[model samples]
Each structure stands twice: as structure tokens, then as C-alpha cells.
Target: MTTADALYTVNVTINGQPHEVKVPARRTLVDLLRYDLDMTGTKETCSVGVCGACTVLIDGEIAASCITLAVQADGANITTIEGVANGEALHPLQQSFIDHGGFQCGICTSGQIVAAKSLLDSNPSPTEDEVKEWMMGNLCRCTGYYQIMESILKASK
Candidate 1:
């Protein structure tokens, strides 16, 4: 089939909701989430996946949605920032971020929280160094690393 006609059927569970969408073969998971599903919490920055701005939990592991194909995420459980909070109440990480000034410009906050949530899920009560190490891939151009670290640390408690 031609590239223009190449389409993929993806069945994914996002934020505890099931979604089935037909997307182009070239569609990225970020696009599918943002465009098709109207879930905009996952941001795309540096599109190469190095910046980690598009990080999301796929089956409880951090995955770069910008670099991941929507088709590749089939049958996966995806969690974005929208899914992190419990209704009107914020997730501990989100509250900690707000309380600790973990975000400045806010462009990277979603990915940062998502990544931090993954870390905490796997390794609750991680050391400060572990938080730093795990969060290194998520870059904040606003240079709010210390506060971000503090937020994660506080949330772990």
C-alpha cells in the first residue's frame, strides 16, 4: 500500500479509558493523544525524544510518546498528566509541584510529573540522587531542576 494510504488501527487504554482509533502509519502517539483523543497534557518538545517533554507511562513504564508510533502503543495502558490527578484533587506530585515551585514556564511540568510518577511507582521513597538521576532526561529550559527535585522528594514522603 502507498504511504499516503497506510493506516493503522490502534487500541489503547488512556488514562483508564479505552480508545480505538485509525491513524496514519506515520502518526506518533503524541499526535494521536493530542489530536485524535484531545488529550493535550502530553507536550512535544525536541521531537527527538531527548528532551523527554513527551514522556508518558505505557504499561507503567516511561515512554517518549513523540518517538513512539501510535500503532506501537496498541494494547498499551497510557497515562498522561491528565490521568495523574484524582478528579478535582491533585496527585501528590502535582500538589508538591505547585507547593514547591517545581515548574516555572510549565512546558516541561507534565512530562516531569509523569516521569516522577513512574519513578515513584517503581521506587517509592527514592533518594534525592535517584530522583535527579531518573529525571535527568527531562529537561526544563526554565532551569527549575532544584524545585522539581524537591517536588518529587516531597511527594515521595
Candidate 2:
């Protein structure tokens, strides 16, 4: 078989649901989620990890899905934006974002929320400086940092 034909099997638990999928060796975790599994909440912008637009939780830590290989996520527990909310109720961050106007244009909202969730999960009550430092990697073209910061701070309370 050619190099392009090499495939790997990844058994991942996404959004608390288990899934086993066959993917090419080169398949990125973002692509696997978006195409193979139809989970598109994770966006791919910079493609590089610098943008943080493709951030997701892998084993409870924030990860850049666009740069992570699907095979690297084998046997891992992943959480995407789609998995953040309860059955019908929105996650606190989701609701806070809406209430606080944390997003504009909405391209970077998912990543911002995911990263903010990670911060809150680790530090339930972080200072403003801490929140700013943690979210520096997530860039919003709409310049909505103030509202985004407000959302995280509000959700922390």
C-alpha cells in the first residue's frame, strides 16, 4: 500500500460517547471530528497551534485539534464545543457569553470558550490578570477581548 493508503484506528471517547474510527495516518484531530464524526464546533483557522481556534479538551487538557494527529488521540477522552453543554441546558460559559456579549462575528468564540472552560476547571476563581494570561493565545479578529474576559469572570462567580 502507498503511504497515502496507510490508515490507523483510533478509539476515542468524545463528549462522553465512545467511538472507533478508521482514519488516515495524516488525518488531524480537527478533521477527524469535523469530517469523520461530523463534530464541527471546533474551527480550523491558523491550522498552526498558535491561533488556538481549534482548541479542544484532550484528556481534560486544552489541545489544538488542528495540529494534533488523530492517531495521537487514540484511547483519549476528548471534549469539543458540542460537548460542553448539558442535554438541553447551556453550559455556564455558553450562557455567560450570550449574556455578556463575549463574541462578535463568532469565529473565535468556540475556542475562546473552550480555553476559558479549561481555565475555570483548573482555577474556579481566577484573577483578571490570570484570565488574560491564560487566554492570550486565543485571538479574536473582532477585538472582543473585554467582553470575553467579562464572560469568563462572570461565569466564575
Candidate 3:
């Protein structure tokens, strides 16, 4: 097989669980998560990295999985939206989103929450401007931004 079709073995710890799989070298992390691993929470909206729909945490840093190759994630720790909550219990950010009406169509909800979680992890007491600036990268077409800000701010308290 040509290099384009070559499959490489990948081992990654996702959500604290170890996983091993062989995938095409060109397979994106998002595809590996959504398709191969059946993790549909990370959406593939713009295909490119502009839209934060495929946002995930790689080694605790927020990254756009759509632009990240699966092979690049070998031996890395990945955290998808599925990893954000405990069994039958929602994360504070998730609960805040629901209570504050942070989502409308819900396409960007997962990404927004993931990104927000990352933001909170790094800056637990960020100001409103900080939250707005941090969340600017994530787009929400249906719902307004006020609710999202409220959710993050409320969750921080």
C-alpha cells in the first residue's frame, strides 16, 4: 500500500481508558473518535479547525481534533465531551448550561461545553471579558451569547 493508505497502530488513553487501534495515517483524531471509537459527541462541523465543533483535550490542552491526525495522538491522552461527566451525573458546566439556557440547536453545545471546561480548568475565576474572549473561538448560531456567558460564569461560582 502507498503511504497515503498506510495504516498505523495508535494507542491513546481517552477519558482515562486505554485504547488501541490501527488507523490510516491520514485519519483525523475526530474521525477516529466519532467513527472508529463510536464517540459521536465531538462533532465534525466545518471539517477544518475553524469551527470548534470537534474540540477535544489533548494532554489537557484544548485542541481541534478535526485538524489533528490520529497518528499524532498515539500515546496521548484525549478527553472528549463524553469524558466531561460522571456516570448519571452531569458536570457543573453541563448543569449550568441547561439551567442558563446555554444552547439552542445544540450543534455547538458539546464544543462550547468542552471549551468552557478547558477555560475553567485554566482560569477558574476569569472575568466576564475573559470568558467572552475565550469563548469567541466557539460559534453558536442559534442561541445568543448572553446565555453561554451566564452558564460559564455561573458554573465558576
Give the alpha carbon lDDT tens digit for every residue of 14-51 in model 2.
99999999999999999999999998889999998998
Q: Is candidate 2 or candidate 3 better by lDDT?
A: 2
Residue 11 CA displacement from its true place in model 1, Å: 0.5
Task: Provide TM-scores for the models.
Answer: 0.96, 0.96, 0.96
Per-residue lDDT tens digits for candidate 3, residues 1-157, read 5677777999999999999989999899999998899999998899888878889999999899999999999999999999999988999999999999999889888999999999999999999999988888898888568999999999995
C-alpha lDDT of candidate 2 relative to the true structure:
0.94
RMSD of each: 1.2, 1.2, 1.2
Kindly list the per-residue Cα lDDT of model 1 for residues 67-145, writing each as its tens digit. Answer: 9999889999999999999999999999999999999999999999999999999899999889889999999999988
**Candidate 1, superposed: residue stretches over 4 Å from native:** 1-4
Per-residue lDDT value at 44 in model 3: 86
Better of 1 and 2 by lDDT: 2
- The worst-scoring run of ten residues by lDDT in candidate 2 lies at 1-10
Q: How far is candidate 1 from the true structure (C-alpha RMSD, Å)?
A: 1.2
